[model samples]
Target: MPAAHAATPIVIRDIRLEGLQRIEASTLFSYLPVKRGDTFDDDKASEIIRKLYATGFFNDVKVSTEGDVLVVQVAERAAIGSIDFAGIHEFDKDALTKALNSVGLSPGRYYDKALIDKSEQELKRQYLTRGYYAAEVTTTISPLDRNRVGILFSVTEGPSAKIRQVNFIGNHVFSDGTLRDEMQESTPNWFSWYTKNDLYTKDKLTGDLENVRNYYLNRGYLEFNIESTQVQLSPDKKDMYLTLTVHEGQPYTISGIRLAGNLLDREAELNGLVKIKAGDRFSAEKLQATTKAIVDKLGEYGYAFATVNAVPQIDQEHHKVDLTLNVDPSRRVYVRRVNIEGNTKTRDEVVRREMRQLESSWFDSNRLSLSKDRINRLGYFTNVDITTVPVEGTQDQVDIDVKLEEKPTGTLSLGLGYGSGEGPIISAGISQDNVFGSGTSLALNVNTSTTYRTLTVTQVDPYFTIDGIKRITDVYYRTTEPLYYSSTTDTSFRIISMGVDTKFGIPFSEADMVYFGLGLEQDRLDIDSTTPQSYKDYVADFGRVSNEVPLTLGWSRDNRDSVLIPSRGYYLNTSAKYGTPITGTTFYKMDAQAQYYYSFARGFILGLNFQGGYGNGLDGKPFPIFENYYAGGIGSVRGYESGSLGPRDTSTGDPIGGSKMIVGNIEMTFPLPGTGYDRTLRVFSFMDGGNVWGTEGESTGANGLRYSYGLGLEWISPIGPLKISYALPLIRHANDKYQKFQFQIGTSF
Candidate 1:
């Protein structure tokens, strides 16, 4: 717009003032679009006036031009002085503010009568949503100090509506029992105490109707539809009626199935993998499976670039369907980089350590699946999704990116527990999942629990060498107050141990590994009273008496998909603890554990765990007490206290000697909270057979094989896991056994 001039040929012949009851012309014209010496048109001038009026500051605006001199006038609406509420007890101030603003009625702003007129309607709408059908609302505006206006809205919220009747208008074929099962509003059930259906919510009703539609559609009701729903409120405004209309379409069956492209000679094999079959119910899920199976089968043949599609040919007249699967095989691709993403704390080496499919490895679906499972078993990530990102300039080379969300992989725990024989127990531990920015794991533990005291620390470095060999080390100080079950008296007998171990791994196969380690151990013993004479004689006669050092060697093979839920694989770990007692005795200890898991048809997870430990004099001095084996607990042999359930001295009736303990537990895990996809809450029935006792000249007896049958519950929680189990002893071995129930943190599994 041009600037104002002394003689701009502008003049005002007449002035038409609008409803200007308060605002001045100068204040109003300051925001006007048109000024002196500016050309104006009706559309332009009207738009300017409309813009000002839309601000809610003015009720009307008027502009007149005489001889090119313009005159503008306006009437400003009163600003809201304050807001007051009454008869509204349930809703607080925040709720009122949101409710009022829905219709544009708010304080500290100009009052627009049109918005105020809609405020009552909006308030009543809010009440209806909350099941208050008969609620009434009124609004009044009053002048306040400083030319401001106050808004007072009076409301009677009335009573919350209760469901009187809920009926489905049009649902057939499926029985009321079946349909009602999908509804959240259960008429009456034994579990009503847990989930009360008496309370009616529109959201729940709508969701039920949606479920009804899905049920029909998934059962080949392609034309299934929900017609309408009506929610009726009673005159007293305390009762509700919900009526639903649904159309269940004709059911269809799979009439035929066909596969196309890139199929190997194992067409029958591919067909078997396809879950969809002729005469089966026409299900979208089955059709999707057919496509995925074709793609996956081709993947096994190195056809990574395979496309599978399931096209449905619907036979409406015959109420049947046919599935057509088409597969296209492109050039086989290989992984350029098996990379990890979204790991802020975990190191690349840690993730890489678990991958079966390495960088530059062929994209074998089997290997990729195995690798994905390996990474998941690390327990670092809550979820791990492997997707192929195409590489530029090469159709046969792709990058495998693992997208993941890390859970609490490491734990810092403090626990207090007790048993009938042992008093109170306390333990503390710290562990790092991704140590040194690599995928190594390390843990340090200290405990003064039961009759044992330990200060132990261990660490694993998966890629200690540039070529991917792993290393592990452990150093510890452990002491035990020894006892003999057969001895007439128990004495305070203890041995101290300090050891360091290191191991290296060899890649046996893509899915297999073998490892070896060298260890150095030292031991000493202090006997406050006469121990078993046999034990003292062996230590004194053989050079294996207290005080000596020994060298050790070991081997292991691990091939489990998940330590928690292994579908197929065997894990074997064994180590030899050999040496003469550092100061008091000479002894050698050996321990080994072998476990296997297999998942069969359905959700059955079969697990077999075998563990055994023993100490020997090795033609030298007797094995030290600290080097002896003691078990009988949840972690070793359940049904007895730690260090209990062993051979006792004949005179004192106290367990004595560094002997052996054997354990084997076979369990089958079943689903709990059963139908959901998530196994966050699960229950399993298991049979545990194990016992602990002293070894006699490399011989293990029946006394160390007591058995138990039990069931367990597991809950995966944010803080940690919660596990509860009850076991009944199938074989009663002794009288000092504990009650068969056990409850512990979830992560222990």
Candidate 2:
């Protein structure tokens, strides 16, 4: 209202709205405080203007009265027409627009300059989190027809800031390098490009600080504290310097361990669960573990809501701490129901059969844990979560809810690999781990290379019987070409074999299974001048073709935490096969493998594997040459050609696989740089040693084991699992064939 209008009171006959383009007259009247035949004053005019402006429909408003007729004029804010981005390589434009919408700035909504400024700051903050310290965001606004405006966010994403140096001060016990090694963030290293540990971000810095805290606390520094941290950016904004000041408190040792509270009359047994003892260094990790163990123990006895608290009694003078564990087993509850959710594709019975915990039974944490592991091992779901929900108004009953996030169980894979010896290997496979959600599996695979070609079809019924027995059937055809032959060789030697096998798996325990199978195969050899003498001798001895009826027995146990990226646990498998004399040649072969994995830290894992094989004559019949075992490959000893180890023909220099094989590997894996703790991608350093030996026929001068060490990369890519290794042979022999670089897709070691 103007001063003139404020001084006079008039009776308004009508209220008029001017400068109305898209707004309606009735809409303006609804906001008017005075109607027709009513007295109007400056107060009413001011009230009318405030209400209209509150709607955010108008940018400017003026009120006046001309001879009892109040007139209102306003300029509305322009509605957003379109939002765009330029020079935005760091983020998707659509994502940016959605982000801006969260801050009340997007198309089809009225535009506000203050909100635009806030959006710009948010955009800049996003860049900073990604190490783009020099990033700049500028907004451009242009008018459009129909009271609308177009928004363009022009961004300049500069080079990412790198951590040039990291320093720790006020440290007496540990060196700067040692502390830095414990932190995730660090200065540039050889693997920095992949790990991005050299990049500095506030979140990563916070995590690094926590890591430092845990490191000290785990080493008995009960009073350790970080005084301060400072991050400095270079003038060019391309480099960063990090400094952490810390107080290293005196170390403390455990004086005593006391157990209190309800122990269910099992104090002695509960006390046995304590991992800490007198005179041992005080460790936060051990304290937490002890508490968790107590709680888990209580849970195993139907106490689903158990609590354990450890209170430390400090004796500062003696540098000792006495720990008191307070246990509370809240309630012994029975499961009212076991509800399964998020398994849209899989049948309920499939998951139910795997569960050891049942409805209407006392809650057992051990059974629940086993159920979770069993579900995970199925590989049908990506994530599984089981939580006990207390029943409303009930103290002794709870519902067990199993939540699952399903993943695609079908895979169509195409693989391409190159080896100095194999020469362009290609393979394709299609498989469904959970076919039609029935918990069965079916697969067809074809692999071809210069040395061999194979086609196989397999089917597996995991629940062949209600007792969890498994049945597997396989039909396969394989052809092997002469290994040392050139592509130009017009005449080459080849061997073809076809077989069908059926196996039944009987579960002896949760992690162990025993398998028995029968197979029949016929091998035919086509010989040429380039064939190795061993192959010719075998053909002549077996009359160019041979049939075998083999019986196999196998045992396997797997308790790994994860099949794809195992961090802990062990796996053992052994198989033995004998050709029945009633049908074909009489021979026996056996193979065994043992693998173990241990995780030292969040992203560091150690894996060890050993494999051995043996084949010999039975009932005076020699072991068939076609059934010999070959070594020296990515899965065996790196830096050596695949299937190129062991005995070689004295004439053609071609590898004649041996009847005995041994291989071992020691590997350490860590998260790939820049990938955080994601285990899908990792880097590993490994040492491998293995050799093959002949007992009956041909032999090569290289008789000892070949050892190699190298670094490798493993990635679960869109196509499949990919592995690349750059190995250097440590002990090379005169006849050893070295392959320094090797890579394969759709395979695992």
Candidate 3:
């Protein structure tokens, strides 16, 4: 055997396109991805030939040259005759047709034998997912008239398999019920396969194994491992069992931690940053993460090149491990570059301007990290990742690379609203969540009603520091008119205020966060006496003070994923307002919402939402209008007006300040038929029951719960999420309140 030597021995002078039946020669030339007179090596020649053949316009391709002139020859492929699908018990022909078309294998298009073969294999695999392990798919191409061929897919969907048993092997610490609960498959009932309960696949088995591993790891089993998993089949080939073997190794605890090498910060001082304490579970991965954290901490002090290695000295006899973190102190690397990526629709400047951390400086690891979090808080991205790329030439330089996944941040929403007595009203709102790349949000709300026009601007930084703190700020200038049947106080008012609030988030655990903040707000309140003295005195007790200062304290704990459509978790927000004549009375308020959603294999989703609010004027100044709770709307208790279901004045019959509100909605949202796999359009049915009433000591004729039931449409669009509903009051109760068939619409920002 002789070895080939590398050389540039061929130069492509003139390129003449030879294939010309169906495809244009110009298109064929472009397929070369290289021009005439370009030199060609074996790698390049092979690549060009492979690309041209990949176009599927040719069954054969050959490249030859004459006097430095390159010639490309291609044999066009045959056209498709018909795609015949059969034995489609699980899916229709049109379904399979669309699936094939997605991969460019439709009947009207040119036929690629390789693609058809791949599709056949995929179809067989797809059947396997549905528990048809013995399903067989055979593709045969028969020539038709005019060199056309028909793709015939012959299928045999064997008997569907049911999980006869699910066993947990090598699980000694936890009960078998725990492991079984994590499994997607269970012992089959009679005809469970027909009921879509017994369908199991390999993916499910693997996922269950991972679930088991995570369960143990999160519970302090640091060295837990999945040894193996096996599936056993019964004699009938219809019943199966999944057995997973796991090795729950000795659980080791942290004996002690030793610091070695370098400490950019004080050794005794930096010790506080280590979250993993002595006697804690010895997690190898968390140890590594802790080491990286140490390095990042050092970088915060301008020690950018710090290297930290956390080594555990195992004492298997005592089931304990001693940790040693060795550090390497290198010269602080300057940030030579900072780059932004994945802003496909948004302009670069938008994100760049939002960045408090700049480029071309001694890379402050703290600032760089804060910058990443600041960008993420913009809510314009699904994900934001910041990487430090080491420069090849200099040890003192590193480039910052920012990659963002842009998400829908702006919403164009239409609002078709109805009142308890008033007719339907159409309005629109357009809002931007990420504005000027500074992580600010801007919103404009307009209603068909003559008095409701508003604009709001808000900004927030999720990472206020290198230690992962979050800061949020909002300023709103809003003006709205109260649609009062009786013209008490002229029925309208313009109120504006500039207030700043800040909160500090304390991470108690992965799933828990404790937050506290303070706000100082100065509000100007004007009481217009356009109504009779009885109406004015009933609300304010006298002439209301025009302006006042309220010191506000707030606290909240959030464990939720989607704010708009939460499936599970709890959210709690409470605040106290005090100052001046209101200081002693505790102007307290609380808001809490809980949601639970469950989805089964049949595509059924059972969900419930509960929200409650309470407020007090604290010393009976007729609780502030803004502090009062308003209910009876689409987002609240449907089949009611936006703000017409609360407490009311006796003389003027206007909704006065309510002290408390409690609302609950049980919803079942399911995908609409004929929708694509994205399932963006959904239909939901709901029963909403809630009420707004007076507090323990207030006077405004606040009463009992108003009830409603409704059907709604939810659409997930590129602009935002859209929701519209038509609700009918179940307890209109002619005795007291306002109740009418209400229609409403909304969208998420």
Candidate 4:
């Protein structure tokens, strides 16, 4: 032990502090046990020294008495000038800095040797949690002038400890492979590098154990329990082994079920929501689901704080369990206010108008969910969250807060590409779905290619009136150079068209809508000797120019869960267009389409689509060739060239489209492997079967159905939706052009 610096017993008139660079004299005095007009003793001096040192702001302390006055001095600790790290590739610098800050060791803070040691230990512990068992951290403090210092934490993060084996013991009812498959962490495999499944984590192990428990519980093992979990690391710390022991009790069957507690006089309705029944095996999952359903039912009746719990009665000898649902319906609550937040760019009214639930109304979970869905369907936000807050003074009044994160709703796209059919193509478009945050849309597009050129402008007002009437207007101009495949030589001709259309949509229900429109169009065909016979005949009958005024009626119903990436629900659309003979060339067109989606599991979806169209001339006039349907290419039949599926001219094998069209598509979409729950990227396998027929000329019936199967990838990139596909045709004609590989960027299908 070192000799005592002083053993003083004296009365201090005033205490003076010295050697403090940043700390104030008053701060030292406040921490000192002995103050002015107090007696100073050895014990007080020792206590004062200990407290000051404990503050972690001082390096040394000295006390002395000078002529009945005490003098206290302290050498303040050096402030950290900078904190840097070396060889830290596993963790980011910012994260390490934050971790050091949590341990009171950061730049601009007073440095202490003890704190540095603590921070190093914490850093090493963090690395261990991340499977970096061989990680080493060495901290260096460099002294500088002006009582400042710099900290350098050098880290050597070795290879992560990979899981070599995972074994489950004492599970008699299930195989070891089955239990291991339920765990997120697994032994090294082909996908281990990407999925990081070979790395062991305590949190992951905990979750895996819970999942194992739930698995047994859901299978009628009412008394299942996990005994212990052991993790063994190799001597080199480069590999790990995990073993889990579980006790799965005998399976039990359900003997009876009963409902108790407050039912709000809706016993029959609540009972109908119970999915579990007598004579079935006892299932924890079913019981929990039934409880949730009962609670949701109560919520529909304004019982916002409802609770339902399933209490089980076990018969040990009989191996049977009886369940009783206990329900408690707290006081019904009413919404006092609805608050919208986090929408910096969008106007409040834009979101508020989509909400179905109103303030001052009884709380309804269904309406609240619908409101959230409607806002999500607008496609203006990335995330939407709704939370209920109880009122401070009232028990039956609550406030709803709708929080949202806005996303970009305006798109500016430019595309340039070359294809065999279209030659060199250049396209550009600018669209705004939420124009000026008014919930209106405007778009303008221009496309130029060797075979076709077009310019279009469109505008839509979703809420043109207070009654939810939608209005859409469109104007377009197009020119096409038909390049028909000729047996001897290539032939071509030119056609120009311009048109304008306006439509009004009336909402009949939340999901159904009816639309009526009128359009005026004119077409002029330039005939040449090289032109195909189909085009020449049409020009000779209808002249070089033809005019038409068309009336259109359409009805659509959309109940999809999401408009951008729907996984459930269905959509249907039907429309008819009739060209008035009194105005110009007479023709009529009818089209009907339906799409359905089914979600089989998390991140798995099945989609089915069907479309049919019929077109013919009125008053015995032949239907205009331009008014025919062309099916093929990326959006139609994937394995064939664009517009190459229908009837072909005998002399020049150019496709003439068709008056009747039918197409059906079935697709299964799943998340990309190793991508977890990321919905932005997906992979899908599809089967497409469809064909176009022409009643105006030659008829190709059921035999014309072209079937194709392929796998495709869809990515929601920053610019737009992109699709890449590789397909093979199952049924094809000899002359049908095959395009096995196709892709489209900056477009949606």
Error of 2 at 665 (Å): 3.1
Write the residue-wise lDDT of candidate 2 on 371-465 in tens digits. Answer: 99889889999999999999999999999999999999998988787645566789899999999999999999998988789999999999999
Give the range where candidate 1 is weakest over 10 consecutive residues by summed lDDT. 1-10
Better of 1 and 3 by TM-score: 1
- Across residues 1-749, which tens digit of lDDT does each residue of candidate 3 receive? 11112254577778876756767787887778678667766666677678977886777787766666666777778788798878879877777777777777876678876888878877877777888777888888888776567989988888877787777777789878777755556666553433354678877667767777777865567668877777877776677777777788777788898788766558886676677878887655566677777777888766777887777777878878788888787787777777888998767866775565677666778787767765665678899988878889787888888898888888887866553333455667777776644444666655554434444444555445644455665554444445444234565443344454555665454335556666655443444645433335544543333234455555566555456655455565555555433222235566666666666523346677777777665555555554567666667877776666766655566665476788888888775533311246677888988878874543454557788887877776444466677788887653234434443334320
Candidate maximizing TM-score = 2
lDDT over C-alpha atoms for residue 742 of model 4: 83
Candidate 3 vs 4: which has more lDDT = 4
TM-score of candidate 3 versus the correct structure, residues matched by position: 0.56
lDDT of 3 at 523: 45
Which has the greatest lDDT?
2
- The digit string of per-residue lDDT tens for model 4 on 661-683 reads 99898999998765544578889
TM-score of 4: 0.82
lDDT of each: 0.67, 0.86, 0.66, 0.84
Please give the lDDT score at residue 384 for candidate 3.
Answer: 91
RMSD to true structure for each model, in Å = 8.2, 4.4, 11.5, 5.0
Question: Distance from true position, residue 36, model 3, in Å?
Answer: 21
Deviation in angstroms for 349 in model 3? Answer: 2.4
For candidate 1, write residues 211-273 as lDDT tens digits.
777677667887678798887777787877777777777899889888777665667788788
